[model samples]
Target: MSFTVAIVGRPNVGKSTLFNRLVGKKLALVDDTPGVTRDRRPGDAKLVDLRFRIIDTAGLEEAGPDTLEGRMRAQTEAAIDEADLSLFVVDAKTGLTPLDKTLGEMLRRRGKPVVLVANKSEARGSDSGFYDAYTLGLGEPVPISAEHGQGMIDLRDAIVEALGPEKAFDEDEDDEAETDVDVSAGSFAGEGDSDEDFEPAYDDTKPLRVAIVGRPNAGKSTLINRFLGEDRLLTGPEAGITRDSISVEWDWRGRTIKMFDTAGMRRKARVQEKLEKLSVADALRAIRFAETVVIVFDATIPFEKQDLQIVDLVLREGRAAVLAFNKWDLVEDPQAFLTDLREKTERLLPQARGIRAVPISGQTGYGLDKLMQNIIDTDMVWNKRISTARLNRWLESSQIQHPPPAVSGRRIRLKYMTQVKARPPAFMISCTRSDALPESYVRYLINGLRADFQMPGVPIRIHFKSAENPYEHKRKKR
Candidate 1:
């Protein structure tokens, strides 16, 4: 069995850099900024002959007991404990600090084997600096350049030694734990892709899987009641009601749509009650499963941090996002209120630039039609398809405007770009130097695609394959 190795370090110390390097892909979001990664992410690790499952954790920090950051710390610590060997990483250039010492002591106390990693050690800034790392009491430190792929052979030998020679690893283990979400990508390329074949055969052909989600007492049940013209879910003035996600099917303009009525989620602090937590989890599951999420924020009090977190989670999951400002009847200035909502959505979530926001009073039935129309429109955007010819044309413009800069004098050639999947669209790029591609340039292409194709709010994914066009190999030239 392939043992697990976890890369742990303080923020921006290049733990994710090592992770992406080992994985031979930029699966982890590497940024100059710290605290960009709020969650512990996992991926495959490969170093020459060595292979294992690797986890990238949030930059460790000691927070007060039971706080959110503290909880995150606990989660990372748990991962460290679960690992067979821990790659305790630190910024080699910055040298060891008190936090590094503290982190080392804490890790050693766990009684697991740890390999000290002094990252960013590509250049010999100070030859004597390597001597200081041994003082942490983890024995010899493996100086590595996670960014430059230096000292990897030494690192791999260390791992095989740590894991021992006798352990037979099954290569098929990762295939069993596969995470690629199997979604259909129907005939389309470049700009837009459709999920044509993989979708289930619904009874009446449900076009949109709409989910209504919001904070407690945001009138989600009431709004759903308005749609059904009958009491569907139990409604109450209490903070957390509607324990389960309830699906309601309805026809709008001869189009079939299934709306999932989810429980009102409260602040994580107030969610200690077992029942409320379960309800929140259920709602989240529905959000992942649904085609479009209608964020139901109360017009009386809009855009809570928890609400924003939910929206962020949806975006991260690559699901389509549509905001439904419920209880609009309560707002004092209707037109001014909408203007603020638009500004807030646009400014706060700029990556989702130009997404649609539908205003409605779930109780008054004031704007349900518009909300439904927005759902259909957003779904169309989610299932968008772009042809190969148009995609390359767009790619050419991207290269000309803000071309990829050379890394180590290697001018990266972005050979081709094409959309292979949808719901939300996924693009695969054939590039010579995928490793050197800057995050800024990647974001540029994403933003440009969204703006040019009118797929602003939909989740757009880009995958880089080093080899010549993978799809081209399968085609038989007549």
Candidate 2:
């Protein structure tokens, strides 16, 4: 039976570093900055033969219950309560401080099994600090260098001993309840599957990966928390409260979804801080990997340049997008405001034509159902595919109606076209003088595909190749 472990300690104590080590991935952002991790992130971690769930939480700090830091501490406490064990990490290079001692006392009162981890033991002058960790009375400190990958075997032994054999080696406990959608090429491959027309079956069992992104303090976290029916993420009036891409698995109307709450992205010029840059990079990564993206906007001030830029970025990445005008409760004329938003979307984001814009209020939970429905619908359209026969018929009709412009007194002949892939559907077209095809013609074809196929608001890609000549080989070598 696998168990859950929570990594907790003061800021800059290498809690996140040890999390990355145990998870065997840099899933949690690690930096010299303290309190970089504000939300508790869970990962399926394996150490030696021991398989378990590990949670990386924000740095423990003494703050009032109303402040952001207090909310972060509450999250950490929740994680500790939920975990079967807690890894109380301490800085072996700096020794235990008042804050660490205070946190140790707090953990001791909870009576949860904790293994003291003295990180940075590989560094010089760490011996004194490592020895000092014994004073906390949390049992022997596992001295290891989380950064240099030293003493992992000892840490594994400690975990095994703490959990005991029954829980540590129980393989029949079943995996985590959450399901992850495989993003590998083979999992979503469509091209060359068959010569006949075939629509690839989409597995509904796997969780749908949806990313919620927007500018700072645009109510992204609030919207997610509302969906979860709990304060799963830290939210406040303060801007930039979230600095990491946090993923949560949830079930919506019997459909599984793995929702990602990303850090707020700012303009490139305003992203001068190193930590913010890291956060932005994390957000962009979420966008690239996600199957669908929701661009949240504050309804009071919608369609800002940065908002449009974010939408463009999502389109450029070829991910399915839905526009969410948040804080709609504050809008006086909701219908008129929504109409205006849709008009702006059409004018500003013509690339994602007919995009669904739902007015929502993250605070009051208004219009969340419609927003989610739009997201589901948009994802379906993004994964749509058209048969070769149907595409050819449409192409033939399109050509007859509006023929390709002649180049250099010669006509551009459109030959054949077929969908090579989906997931932001892409098509390959065979034509005469492919290099001479105008951009307008390509846009025309793309628009035709969208309109004729009813694939609205999803990015479509089209490529052209020269039609092979059967008479060239018969002409003989020169």
Candidate 3:
């Protein structure tokens, strides 16, 4: 059975730092900025033999009854109530304060096991606060530096003592539930799986797998909803409502397309929860696996750093990428928007060849058909494969059009090229000296291949390999 624990304290007392430490990852954002964390995040944690679930909550503040802060306090109290034990974290360097006293009394009245964590206690003069924490009446304080990895052993022992030996565990039902939940989650931790509604296998053919990605509240899910003619994903004025990446399959004009509705990605500076961390991982996985990726950005606020990160991931993973400016209906000027998008792409990510940017409106469905057509065209380009004859033929024609540059007064021989794989085509080229090849020249070849083959908006890779003449090698062997 999974036991629960909560790390409760005021803001910036290293509660999130300790949460990230126990989770064994930088899943929670640890900024010096106060109130950066607005949600209660939970993750599976382990310290020594103590395996359980740990929740990191928003800092508890003194609020009047039934206000926002009071509701937040209720959430903290409820999470504490739900846990098997609580870790009350405090800044040992600053010593005891009135907030500490108020929370101490609150935890005391709750009657749950509490372990006082004297955070930021690694340096000199920290002993003064250590002495002061004793008066809080939460038992002995474990002096520790969460960022510096101090006092973890004592923390582990405290956890085991509070949770262990309380009751006998039944492993069978627990394992069953965990297995079910894990399967539903797939690569992610918290999301439930789709119902396998679209098989993509009816006619011995599959449609293009296209995924929609962007920063949070950028109309990613909105685009998919318009294309499907319904709001399959819950839509609202609130941001961050769609926490799970949802997928739905449909036919778009003789093309079988699987569209993934992903949660809006937020910057790491903005993400502070265990759930948001899992959501980001899930979205990244979808981008990697999908054949074509259509990144949606809000027309008003496009090309933020987080959006750039999404675009970079798609390109790095070699997926065909199409940029969509969603909520075009709200844009006051369409021509200016497209111009700015082109300028942004050119300035920020010029390495991409055959990429496309389109303006779309998920709310009014104005440019929905054009977006679908672009996706189909892009997916077609991504899946293009060429035979060796066609590839070498193109190579010869390309050389005739503009031969490769000479190096050190010697003509560089570009012997051959052939497609190796194509879910976004990757090719192999045989050359005399690949070390002399500039990335710009390689990009030239890729662009020629894309233009001549009528492939666009899909990522392509060109690899140079040095190989000896096969006929001479065969003759020598004989």
Candidate 3 local lDDT, 1-478, one digit each (tens) = 4577899998779888898888786656566766544456666676665567787777889988455456456657778988878999989888888998999999999998888889999978999999899999888888889998889998887666665655313133444222101121132211222222211211214446777888777887767777888645555566765554555667887666777777778887878877777677767777776767889888888887887888888988988788888888887878876887788787887667557888888888887788777776776666555667777888988888877788888777799776665665788889977888777788789778778877765677888897766698779888
Question: Every model's Cα RMSD, please?
Answer: 18.1, 2.2, 10.1
Off by over 4 Å in 3: 26-43, 62-84, 105-114, 121-140, 166-296, 301-329, 332-414, 418-425, 432-445, 448-456, 466-478
Query: Which residue pairs in candidate 1 have backbone atoms (N, alpha carbon, C) closer than 3 angstroms, thus clashing?
Result: 189-386, 191-386, 192-385, 192-386, 193-384, 193-385
lDDT of 2 by residue, 1-478 (tens): 3789999999998988888888787888888988899999998787888878899999999999999899999999999999999999999999889998999999999987889999999889999999999999899999998898898899999988888878778775455534223444355546566555777665566568899999999999999999999989999999999998999978988988788999998899999988899999989988988999999998898888999999999999999999999998899987787778777788988898888888899999999999999988998888777788888899999999999999999999999889888888998989999999999999999898889899999999998999778899878875
Q: Candidate 1 — worst ten consecutive residues by lDDT sum?
A: 180-189
Badly placed stretches (over 4 Å) of model 1 are 1-206, 468-478
Pairs that clash in candidate 3: 354-457
TM-score, one value per model: 0.56, 0.96, 0.55
> Each candidate's lDDT (Cα)?
0.76, 0.89, 0.74
Candidate 1 lDDT over residue span 1-478, tens digit each: 2778888977788987898898776555566766544445567676786667787777888897456556457657877977888999988787888888999999889887888888888766734557788899997888889888999988887776666765415455546433212222242223332432233222224346778888888888888879888654556565554655656667778876677877788778878855566667878877887878988888888888888887888888888888888888888899987888888998888777877788899888999989887877888788776766788888998899877889899888898877776678888999986877888888888998987877878778898878656677568563
Predicted structure 3: lDDT: 0.74
* Better by lDDT, candidate 2 or 1: 2
